[model samples]
Target: MKLVTLAIICVLMLNSCKNKSQEEPQNQVKVEKIEYASFGKEIVASDAIAAKSMASHYKTMKTGDSIDSKMVAKVNNVCQAKGCWMRLDLDDGNEVMVKFKDYGFFVPKDITGKEVIINGKAFVKEVSVDEQRHYAEDAGKSAEEIAKIIEPKRTYSFEADGVLVVQ
Candidate 1:
């Protein structure tokens, strides 16, 4: 009787182990292939809000307010001199100025019109005329265009920890 009980327990343990092994594969998550060119800290392209939604968030933000977020948008322009900064179209007429965090990374200068996902802190601020002119120069704007930035402008800004340019 004792021998029979021990054999039953052994059989049950073996069966349970077999079941767990079979279930392991099903429980594993599928990792999709990465198809983006990465810059700065690596980031996955998941859970990023669309440009339209991001625009709405910006609309609700006041100057000095900031939120941590990830968003996808089309590149409207890039710093012509060094790709140090980029402007992303929010699907509306508004564009968000994105700069790398800690001056850590730069994107491709010719990425205009390409889609990208950026992980960052978004904020609204008043851009000084001098800074505006500086950015305009970086963008290779004409002297007349730079000169026209006389007044401070309220702008949507982002400090991106990572950027993924969709291929």
Candidate 2:
């Protein structure tokens, strides 16, 4: 009986040990209420909060750098069907495509011309023709318009986890 008890204790101790691979941090969402809310959804998180990055600052940064930039920029356009994506004016007729990280969240659809602060990682990418057409479709562009995308284009992209529309 004592041997069985000792063996049970040993098994219990082994079972209590934690694996290091399971120690990764989780994205805990914190809700933030807005006194004067815009057309978009309320702020769901404040992760890695930062001030907006300047357009020129983006132009100066090297590609592939891990950027957690909080940028305040004008909304050029949005995915009209759904707020799954948006384009922010980066000055000089340039724009950066903003998408939600992991398809986790979406912005307001009618937020065009409004100012928004986005928190995300920014990088430059060569978007393929197929994907560009898919984005155009998501934007509710005409079939002719999507067909116009024949070549891949290089542009800055941001994968945002949080977005706040400025008043």
Q: Whose lDDT is greatest here?
A: 1
lDDT, candidate 2, at 19: 41
Residues forming the 10-long window of minimal summed lDDT in candidate 2 = 36-45
- Any idea what lDDT model 2 has? 0.74
**1-167 in candidate 1: lDDT tens per residue?**
99999999999999999999999999989998858999999999999999999999999999999999999999999999889999999988999999999999999998999999999899999999999999999988999999889999999999999999988
Query: Once superposed on the true structure, which residue ranges of model 1 sit more than 4 Å away at CA?
Result: 1-34
Q: Which portions of model 2 miss their true places by more than 4 Å?
A: 1-53, 61-63
lDDT per model vs. reference: 0.95, 0.74
Compute each candidate's TM-score over C-alphas.
Answer: 0.79, 0.66
- Please give, for residues 1-167, the per-residue lDDT of candidate 2 as tens digits: 99999999998777665443355334457777643233333443344233234556567776665566767678989998778899988766788899988887777787899877777688877899999999989888899999899999877888887777865
Cα deviation at 7, candidate 1, in Å, is: 52
